[model samples]
Target chain A: MHNEKVDILLIEGNDYEAKLALHNLKKHNLTNNLLHLRDGEQAADYIFATGEYEGRDISNRPKVVLLDINLPKMNGMEILKKIKSDERTRTIPVVILTSSRENRDVAEGYALGANSYIVKPIEFGSFSETITSLGLYWAIMNQEAPYIPNNLWQSISEA
Target chain B: MKNILLMKFFSTAAVTPKRFHFSAQKSEFEISHIPFKDSGVSVVNSSGQLLVAKQEIDTIETKPVMRTLHNARKIAEDAIIKNCPDVICALDRKGRFLTINDACVLWGYSPEEIEGKFFTDFVVADDIEKTLKAACACISTGKRTSIDNRCAHKEGHSIPMLWSVSWSADDNLFYCSGRDASDIKSAEISLQESTQRYRSLFDYNPDAVYSLDLKGNFTSANAKVAELTGCPIDQILTMSFVPFVDPEYMSVAAESFRKAAAGEKISYDLVIIDISGNRRHLNISNMPMIVHGKFTGIYGVAKDISESEANKAELKKLNESLEMKIMERTSQLEQSIKEMEAFSYSVSHDLRAPLRIINGYTKLLSNEYEGKFDADGKEFMTAIIENTKYMSRLIDDLLNLSRLGREAINKTIVDMNLITQVVIHELKMEDNSIVADFKIQDLSPTVCDQRLIRQVWTNLISNAIKYSKKKGTPQIEIGSYEKGNQTVYYIKDNGAGFDMKFAAKLFGVFVRLHDRSEFDGTGVGLALVQRIISKHGGKVWANGKVDEGAVFYFSLPNS
Candidate 1:
């Protein structure tokens, strides 16, 4: 059903890290319906279809949001808070894909309703391997949240 | 003196020559007969040693003997009363004096004056009862009795005197004789006073005072000793000090006792288990007790030192804990340093990622423009490759320096000579252009972190080889010796030696003295060597002159 709808939302602040993630996800064919955002602020807007995305569809929430902790404007932890606290967006599982492996960050990320915590390492092929498996899981294996069709998404946005 | 009077009376009754003998001295004496109607009596010396010398028997003259007896009144009056040295007096039954002698004057009285007064007037009031008893005995038993009493002297002081008296039944009077005794009485009083003073000092002293016999059995102990030993005074005195001493210190206790018994003043510290079985430390001083110039016993004074000893031990414990806390804080600081170094190293190591990206994209550009670039562009490509490789080497060196800081020091005994040989062997395997003649001396063993020390040796030796390689036969000497309580290992090289002025900068990271074209190096070798050696509580220094030689010395403190 997601062939016509967005399936995964990739949020990354670092340009290079974003390039690597997007490149690897495309290799698994999971990038076809994916939307890439640079910061937590845009990721949250795209998810809830508010602010700059005022007329955007909200019902077609991505099955998962690939997140980064270090952001330019709004940080990942704060974005995770907005998504999980709202009834309409709370079920969209968020996967943190930051380079930081600090225990405090991992613990705080999960406690704020993040679905999974993954530390991003820059060691050669490790980054590619991590994002590929993550893309395969969320796009192909993981079931979407109630499968809201395009028309339903438009209605939810209009309301 | 009285016996001589008796002999005189007898000789007179015998109607012979009428001679008399007196024994006051070892000589003869005679008292000429001038008979009074009152008869004489016998006499006594204060020492009682006098005896009548001879008795001349004139038994054939019975009439003369009877006549002598009839004149016994004369014998009593003249012999005992008149000649006695003591205060002699005759008192009637009413206690009135009838006759007084010359000694009465010594009591500030005369015979005529005291004869009519009461005998009690001459006796001290404190001794009146005793003096009267002596007077009454003469009347009741008709026998002589003496009592020591003080007679009141006219000057208001009392003279202690001994009086001998008897009753004359026919005359109804008591005849008394007194001798002075003030000297002996005063002496006895002084003795009593001194004994009380000494006793008070023994009983009232605050510190424990104990007396023991020559056999070490407790003779007596004061209240303070009883309190110190946690026993009653009476009970403690009944026991020897041996039971109170801890068994471990028994030998020392015995030695102290021996020295004290030997008449030497000795003192020592011992643990005493008091009555409650609590161990107490006591400082005891002992000396021999002497009586009549003979060593009779031992006396000791002791004080409880348990509290002071405990305080000293507590101070020592506090000092140890203080040292341990300082050590803990120092190690915590060291841990932070290691963590900070690891952070920097990890960041540098991560730089390899973007470096990989740069390398990949550059290759991508080069492939996209294959054969499309001019010679100048090709030269630029080569320069990029050269710079990247140089950066890679620099990053590797940076990581190594930081790794030395992060690694835990795993110390093991290392043979420096063997380690040097192995490092040189490795250098040959890595770069055969490092052709060198090596001179290695026997090196002492050192306890060090083996892997880190291997890195130290590798860096120092390779620098020595790399620098001196221009020599036809490159010379490098590796040796270790002791200096200033540290093991100093040095590497000497016959190569491009910098001036002594530049020696200070030799170990700075990325500081190279020579031109890069002359010798290819990362300029981090000496800096890494210095870092590793310093982590092992050592320091590195170099001494060199232009073109002569260079010697790098590093010293490790013996742990």
Candidate 2:
């Protein structure tokens, strides 16, 4: 179960800025198995198997998780903390996409265990290119760590 | 004819009655005559009877010889009486008095008394012996002479007199005449006083006065002219007056001298260069003078006017510098006006573009997709539209405040109570939910711009309403009071107050004291209020306690 591979998990706000980014990822076929979670809490349940997270395997995780900071309910920073602190989900690849070009947000995103930080551009052409390159890098080229449960005894049997 | 001639001679001789003679041979031959007083001849016999006397024949009495003798005596007597001076006396061979005239008698003596007295008694004691010797010498040598001496008068007082002495040879007497000499003595005293007055005026005059000859040379000068030119009086005598003038003005000095020589009284302001080549201002007054109908040389007076000329030049320089400073200040004021106009255009054009986009899109979404979307989705779009509208109002107010700070304010006396009341009424009309309690104090008069102060009141009262919306009654009090030399105004609200820690940021643009959910405001209100107050040369600030109340205060200085 720890060796099983998963597809994409998308976390964003305002369908306008995030949908424009998703249109370009389809060119590289990185949009396959993509799921759009509207806020930080839905993204947390998809990764953590908590609250209404029934029939979800706690060990299987996606190859890439795209996050946006400006969101309703729990912000992306609190979700990043939950994902990095859990033993079984610590090895998932996470990328941040945000509308703000402020240096404060960039510094804060990387400090919270986000693997990559990308500023969403206003122009459709530039936004598409940034999203395509970032999606291809994390989904295909980068290697992810094996998920480990809280009890280490079950991890040796799965390997 | 010979007998008649002898007869004529005898008869003419007989007319002088003092002659008595018969022939040269015999006296007793019977010749007799009576003598007349005027005629000197007489003829008589031994008897005292008339014999060919001057009165015997008419023809003989008419003889010219007798007539000539009588005429000579009358002339001598008339001359003595007519031409005698005030003091005349006759002296004998021994210097004794022979006779005295009426003039001599009036000299404190009687004619009979002075005739028998000696002439030396009337002479002064100091010169009596000398006068006697001079008189005796003149009489013996047959020469006439004169002398000046004091003579004694009959009243015992002496008078200065001049005596002229001459001797009569036949009578062996000396004649003397004396004239008074007192007029010459008084004329000598007047000459000395004029000399003293001239010397006093020469030493005391302020100008350097001097007299020059026909050639422009110094004849005499006072001490100041020598001191001013740094030359001694002896040196000035040898040096010509031309060398003391500046070299460039030498011809000017010569022309002045030429005019003076032509009998013209002329004056000129001349720059005189001394031995050290330092220029001085000299006012020279030159005049040609004549003494006793003879043309004398020019007289000159020179005065220093250097300080007055320097003061005039300094005043002119100060006036020029003052004009330059006024021109510089006017240009700086014009430049600030241009910059303010540009800032207003940027606020209206550049800033409004983005806000219009945010507002227009949100409105389009609500109108077109309101029925299809859930309730939460519709509410989110409405909030965005309201926030953008608030931002546009904030921009308009801020630009107006910035313009007030840049432009010059026209300060005039205004009543604070009336201005504050108008502002409070206007704010209440805009939002009826805000209940206002105006406890306005009788504010004193102040010198300030009325328009800028009105902006101050509008901003402060509106902020009180925006923050106090949560209060049940929404109580607000606006009032003013006098403190020392300033009039302080306050708008107090019982609303959601801010933390004291962030009170420093209350007057900054976009510095919100309350969250957007708790109170709805752009946060630019207090900033605009502060700027408008500052333009009128006043100050603004706020004080508060969290959740209790807030008070905004501003002050104007006593003008």
Candidate 3:
């Protein structure tokens, strides 16, 4: 039930892109399971439970993070590095949805541990369709990383 | 009579007919004659040798001896009077010809006419004083002296003659021999004229003409050389060429003069210092001076070329600056092109964001308010959505065109058959409700940018299917053939083809041959195809007939 609650995290630089991406994901019936973070810094904070997201349950990791490269405080490559470096959220998938097909950001994003790189098309129809399929792929079809609750994690360590 | 007889006795005694050996006394003629041959008059025997003056000699020889002396005098006068090569004449103290030889006829005068004529009258007036001086000298010295004077002919022309005159004191007469000298005089005159012409040429020539003696010392230099040095000719002649030549070329001038003095002709370029101390370039040609097969000196001519040399240097400098200017302009153009590429990327990303939102909101409006809007409002929203979609496609096509200029080609071996099949399958899948009968032919492989070539296939196959879908069971044929050095791939479709006359407008970015009601699309497909094909160094063309079918072909390099 805890894994079912915190489903996907959307880190989008543009508000419109985030709205469309969420709209597409909600169309796939993943509305209650999705969380929209504004920028890479806020996304990192939400994942690590720091800054504005302090004292939050850190173990309730989302199934996937849809990251956009062009962000305000911390760009996607930096945030991807932070999440992939941490063992707690390292196994969670982070897919890049960006407006830029510029090879520099794409190559850097993958090297910094992005799972998939997708270009946000300007046509709303195709844009929403790509996000919908990616959402279904990550939330429904994809297997989640094993989560060990606090009690179970402590006991497994003792054994 | 006794003197006449004595004359005949002397003649007989001086020229005896027989060999008579006589020894005469030193004082006079106390002589003894021993004649062994027969003698007309008998001489005495050796003991008594005296023979009295012959009383018979007076009777026998007076008339004959007198006649013989007269005949000998006439012979000597005749010998002096006749002349062939020389005109013989006798002149008095006043230089009058008393007796003239027959050779006077050579001057159109007879001996009788010239006799008793004043010899000075036949002499040219210009030579009269000289002739008179020679006559006086002849009388005083009584020796042969020569005079070259012109003599007047009877025809009013003068001929040069060389006269040899001598005085005979005994006869109180001067004898003269006159010889023609016309040829020698004319030869001397021509030689003087030739020397004058050569001197005029040297003085008037614009170039500096100078001559050096065998020691490389200046003998004579023309006025031009003086003008160059700003010195008079006499002063230039006194000065050697060394002072006028620049110090850098002083040794070279010396070497060249040495060569010329050795009877070798040489020429060289040198720099000289002018009166103002400015350096001037000069070309000097030196040749050995030979006179009558004897080495005389070296003659040379110099020409100033300083202005022309300066022009050559200026032209070279201009050419170098021109090359630099061209390079600068080329770099400026390249900078503008790079800035334009960045601007194209900005247009692609930033401009499309709003268009996407416009399109996304319209979709939401239609979905949320399914029946809230009337049919007119709904249709208007659809139009907005369609127009937004077209604008997005225009941005993409424009980006592709500008990107072709910016990005380098990433070439690979592209298989046309597989690419055509993939394009066809993708085109049908994008609109799966449509049916297409694709006739694909054998296609060869090519080396090109795989992504751009795939774009080419995508635009072309989609165009074919979109246009031909109006027909029942739309038929499309994809084939390739070989042309000169290239392979041409064609897509033929049974479609609503365009008029051939408007084919030129088909590839324009915003041009649409068909109405929006008949076909729903932007006109960027063919333009994108053209851009991609040309980026691969190829060409594209389309042929279509109204109500018939259409075929689009594109070419690429075989390798």
Candidate 4:
């Protein structure tokens, strides 16, 4: 299941929020190659091919990573910092999708190289609309960066 | 001329007389014979005492002529001794008065009555020894000696006398003269009393009174100077003022002293260390001591002000510490505000998530399983969704209210008429069923935070519409008028007015006057309106009656 081409990675800690996001993405037909991680730690492991995903191909990165700010382990901000700092996955667009509309979190998310910061609304219609637009935009409309091999990246950095 | 002719005839005739007799009544002369030279003639009185023997007589009647010349000389001498103003007296060797002149009346004594009395009897008891000593010295040295003593008067008062006595060895008597010295004595006494008064004034003064010589050495100092310098008066006088002055204020002290010595009165403040090493702040005044039209020294009066100086320093320190404490408290308040904002943000996010999920699933349940649900179940589901939305609005209003506290007001001149019109237009658009006729008048422009003031108008206008919409023809009037330094705006409505008693509770958070079933409200609108107006330094109040009408008024300062 982990070997497949992951188009979108949803890293949400809450079960209900994750289910709702998945449902909305499925309704929009953007869940075909989507992978949902329950916590920041699992998402980090999958993204960097560490821990349980050590043997996995690190070159096969997701197109977009949807991050929630509040998480159980290795919270969303820490995960965002790790992903943006690593050369292997820095190019992947990390969109912050959280329930918090706090200015501090929004500013920090963008400062840490998040592609987009969106607040999840409470109403069903508005929430459904936001998740659907977010999924369609990141998965279908947004252009993904071209993948470069590790040797090429190393050479480029040295040069 | 007749006597000269007679004298020439007698000389030529060689006439002499051993005894002469002349009677003015008889006009005859009898002369007795005596030895006589051919070229000289002698005239004698009837007692045969020779009156003149060197000159030739003109006739044997020369006795009367001789007696007349002697009487004239004796009269002049007696006049002089009788009229002398001083007590000119002759005293015997035993200090007895042999004779005294009429000037003895100055001592209340007659010359005849005091003739035989001892001179010492008239001397004051206190001066007797001095008078005796002076007389003895005069007798021994035969020199004139002067003494000042009091003579006892017959009236019992002592008369101050200045006596000059001389011993005459030929008569073995003391010739003494005494003058009245009352005036001199009174002058000396007054001078002594004035000096005493000045000395007391100097010593008893509270301030340190001292005099410094031209070289800045202490010449004289009062007792207070001893106390202030923590040194004895004698020691202070032995030292100059330079050693007692604090080094920091030595130059100032020197300058003031120099100016004073130059005859300029100078006053200055300086610090001094006393003998005990205690620092004393002093305000000193220095003036030139002009004695007998000459600048003699510097007179100084110093007042200790150490206590007041210390208090001033303490007050300055307290002011600095108070300012520091205020800054500390202000930062603490800012920190708490930041923390509260964080908490509100967390509440906004965390509290709404479950509600969102509940509402989302409920809507999905209603839409997907519409056939299985009965009418009541559907209504219950609808209520859940409605209540969730209401709770969400309540949370949003609460956040907005809390956020108002920390929001920095950006103020500008806002037109009240325009904001009211916009709010009215927006309210009409939101609910077209609001057929309440609006009577908006020309409003004065005021300085306020534009965004917050707009929110105020929105809340007030919507409240008016909501409360008055049930009337047949709801009449709403909005107008503003100038009140003192403020522009007061009012919104009146014909609606379900609350009791006037609960008017004070209207702006309280979550304090609803009407039941929820009658008027649908979360009870936070008026509170938000109040908060916004208050933050702008404005006031919000309402006047209402039961079922008649309610009018809300707000005043903004016209700056």
Candidate 5:
């Protein structure tokens, strides 16, 4: 499991929301290497290779991280800060997918360096369409940052 | 003896037969005769002495003439002593009264009773030593001495006496004259006491008290004046008050001084810099010092008021801080309201996800198990989907109502006639099958939020059309008029109007007058209209009668 390369990292606390997002992503055949974490802490552990995810390869980063603002344990904002602040994972695209349309949340999400901010729709058809389009755009169409070898990235960070 | 010598000479002259002039030349008498006109004659000698002459000799009657001369001298001595008002007395060397005048009776003593008594016996005990000392001084120095002493009267009361005594060396006596001084003594005592009282009043006063001369130099100042200026009394007396006065108040001080010097009393307030260089505010009053009807200079008193000025400044600062605090609290209240609205919006957003899931699953079940289910099962699924959709609509309406509370109204001048026309055109396009007569009147323009006012028109006109569609021939009338400072617009319909009793609840949220079977509505359109009008500082109302007609009105400020 630690040796596999992941494509999408979905951090969602609610079971129904997680199921819906995964089902929609699967229906579109976006990625087979998707990893779903129930809370912000597990997502941080898996991303930073700390605590339960210690000894995992430190450079096998995901292509995109889908985040919810309201989560158990560490919340989505703290996880975003952790992911964006680290040099190894800084280039990974973070998309904020939450049920909140508050102006403050959108502003805070963008201010913390979120790549994309999308509000989750309430109707099933709209929610399905939004999730499916997001998968297609981030996983298939958009170009990701060029990856550097682990030792080379360490040398660059040191410089 | 002199009278006898005069008698001898007159007897010799009476025997001579001529008018004789007697002249004494070196202890001898020279008698000469001149031509005589009568038997008895009188002449004056060259030394202005009187001489008597008689033609007949009278040597035998000389004794009787001497007796008459002595009696005449006695009468003259008695007249001099009887008329004098002062007590004139002669004292012996031993301080005894040798001879007292008739004026001794004024002291309740006759001259005869006082003549042999010691003078010290009549002097009061308190003054006996001073009186004896004056007598002794007069005798020893042979000079006149004056003393004030109380003399004991015979009636047991004392008289204040001022006495003058002289020592006569030849006679070995002291001649004394005394006068009553009771009135002058009492007047002097009262004057001294009053002067002391006024001096203390000036010294002990809390305010600085001082007097100036005609030259504006301090003539006299009390203890408080020295304390107030932080200067010594001598220094203040030498210096003019001009140096102590603050530069700004120099003119005011001069004017007050001029008024006081012109015989007018004046008072004023000024700031002064004391010797220690501290600023003090003083309220001063001055009075004219007049002596014998002439104006002199100023009298002043000053009270310190710096503390009160500072307190006034402090109170003004406190009032400003209080206003700032009120503003801060108001902004805090607004922030909390915004937070609460955000919480409700999130809650409404979160509620939709479950509803969507339910609607989605029910549809899938109905479509997938179409052949296996009965008619009742299909109907249940449909009911669930419809109700879920209705709930979703309710959430959206609630969110819109809450959002309106926080929305900033952007106001502009809008043409009510054009807004009504556009709304009517839209309503007709929405339902072309409905037939009605529309009466549109000239509507006034008003200042309002254009978009919100358009919503108000749409809600009112749509309500009018929906409620009147059952009529045989629906009639809808739209118009506006100027009412006071407001532009009032009304939409009237000849339709199934509500009862007048429930008119008060017409604009309340979720309050519907008719059953859902008769009328289809969310009961939020009128509420939204009411809220929009209120936000624009306007009003909304309605008038109705069951089955007759209904008229809905809204008013906006003209400016």
Candidate 6:
């Protein structure tokens, strides 16, 4: 039931922009079963189903992960690295979308195995189009890995 | 007219031998032959009366006939003497006067009164020797000759006269006719006046006009031409005209002269030496003057051409500078195009990505974890959202700087202090947190793009407020003064100041002298200020030391 509840994970910081984007995504019908993580460390620990997310099912990896760059604690780049480095979540798709098209973020995103990098458009119409396309692509078209039983997946992870 | 003829005949008779033919009437003795010379005789009657005398019937030589002839001649001569306009006088063999016409009598004494006076006494002292010599020659040769002499007028001044003399063989008398030549003297005076008028025109004409022979000798020149050429007229007459020309222009001068002498009108420029030995440029036109189909000399007129040549040189330099300025403007336009491209890339790359992250994950948060997170967790997420929105604002300021750099200055009259006050008032309306002490001084008007100048004031005033936000009471002073011909304005702020060592990078885009944490700006405001001021033919500078308040100064063109 716990694994079924967390269908997707989203990490973001800037509260106003985060709220605006959240409103936009809710209209797209993609984030109905999604979970929100505020900082890099929380996002990393929860994905591995350790720390705050311990005792929860780790076998059910989310369909996708959305990340924002400006954060209160550990930033988006480190969160992306933690997910790609682990065997259990390495196959999970991570999409980085931010207000800053800062060179460091784009380069680090690619280096850390980010699946997609998108810059938020300023105009409302273009932002809507960008979110709708991202949702359709990752949720409907992309082929997610089948759920591995906890015994097999965790035993392989322990080894 | 008849009196003039009789006087002419009597004067001729006094000089010529007396000869007459007369006829006798009932009581009048008429000499048929009276030898005007002594070789003939006249006849008389038995009553001792005069009668016609003749050596033969055709020629007369009788004493009565000679007396009758002499009486008749005297009567005719008296009529001529009374009517002649010119003075007429006779001189004896000894150069003494024998008779005079009425004109001569009127001119001086009567014929009887001066009959024996020597002719030299009537002549002026200077003319006496010449008169005596002419008289002696006339008496000896008995030749009809004329001489000009100054004779004493009745008023005691000398009157010029021409006298003609001949010998009379009959009475052995020397006969003379003297005519006053005062009319000739008046003609001479008129001739002198015309010569002086011609000379004055030549001497005072502005253009130097002179005549030169084919040999390059200056044959004639006006007084001014002589002075301009630095040669006396007498000296120039013998010297070569080529000597006054600069050595470099001598060949050209010679060729021009040769062409002119060959009947070709030649015009050219020459550098010549003036009276003070200073070189002068003259435009000279030379042409050959011919009289009666014979080439006399070359006539030339010269005017100064130095100023015109200098003006041409100045115009050439100005054209060169204009071309250089056009080239510089074209290159600047090209550079701005490239910078605009870079700015577009910055918009797409640096600005949009943060906005995307903020929008995307913030959406994920509220949607996925709305009821799950605590209030503090939600608050932290909201702060991230606020900061990213501000980041977009910073990017816009950067784009504004790029745009400001590219636009051309649309110049108009602007009052800088007025603009500063408006910006200050706007800022005050937005944030009333800090007390701002504005010491605004009077500002002069200058020609500038008012809209661009508004941006300048907005940037500087906003920056002052932003930098001084933390201070308990912000004191900002806006003032302007004239330096040389330009109006310089400054915004002084009581705030955290920056080091002056980084002044070199003050106007560079996004170059912040202060830390972003210290001042809430993208560092594009001052750069925009500088760009707008620089476009107005002005410059901007910042003066600040650490911990001291900073002052930003900019200047605008006076006109």
CA lDDT of each candidate?
0.76, 0.71, 0.78, 0.84, 0.81, 0.74
TM-score of each: 0.40, 0.38, 0.53, 0.67, 0.52, 0.39
lDDT of 2 by residue, A2-81 (tens): 22345677787667545555656776787766777887777787787766664578777788888877677888888988
Candidate 5, DockQ score (0 to 1): 0.22
Model 5, range B356-410, lDDT digits (tens) per residue?
A: 7787667657766788889998999888987887787777777777778888999
- Model 6 clashes, total count: 42
Q: Please tell me which predicted candidate would have the highest TM-score against the true structure.
A: 4
DockQ of each: 0.05, 0.02, 0.33, 0.49, 0.22, 0.11
DockQ ranking from best candidate downward: 4, 3, 5, 6, 1, 2
- Order of candidate numbers by TM-score, starting with the best: 4, 3, 5, 1, 6, 2
Q: CAPRI verdict on model 6?
A: incorrect
lDDT of 4 by residue, A1-159 (tens): 368889999998888878877888888788999988888788899998888888888878888899888887789999999989887789999999887776779899999999899888888889889989888888889899987777898999899
Tens digit of per-residue lDDT, candidate 3, span B260-301? 889998889989997788888888999999999999999999
Q: Give the DockQ of candidate 3.
A: 0.33
- Report the number of the highest-DockQ candidate: 4
For each candidate, give the TM-score of chain B: 0.44, 0.46, 0.49, 0.61, 0.49, 0.44
Candidate by candidate, in order, the iRMS in Å equals: 5.4, 10.0, 1.8, 1.1, 2.4, 6.5
Native contacts retained by candidate 2: 0.00
Q: Which stretches of candidate 3 lie over 4 Å from their true place?
A: A1-9, A24-65, A72-94, A111-113, A122-129, A132-159, B1-273, B279-335, B368-381, B409-454, B457-465, B468-495, B533-544, B550-559
Off by over 4 Å in 4: A85-88, A148-159, B1-206, B220-223, B230-235, B243-279, B283-301, B309-335
Tens-place lDDT per residue, model 6, B94-130, is 7777777667654476666666788777788899998
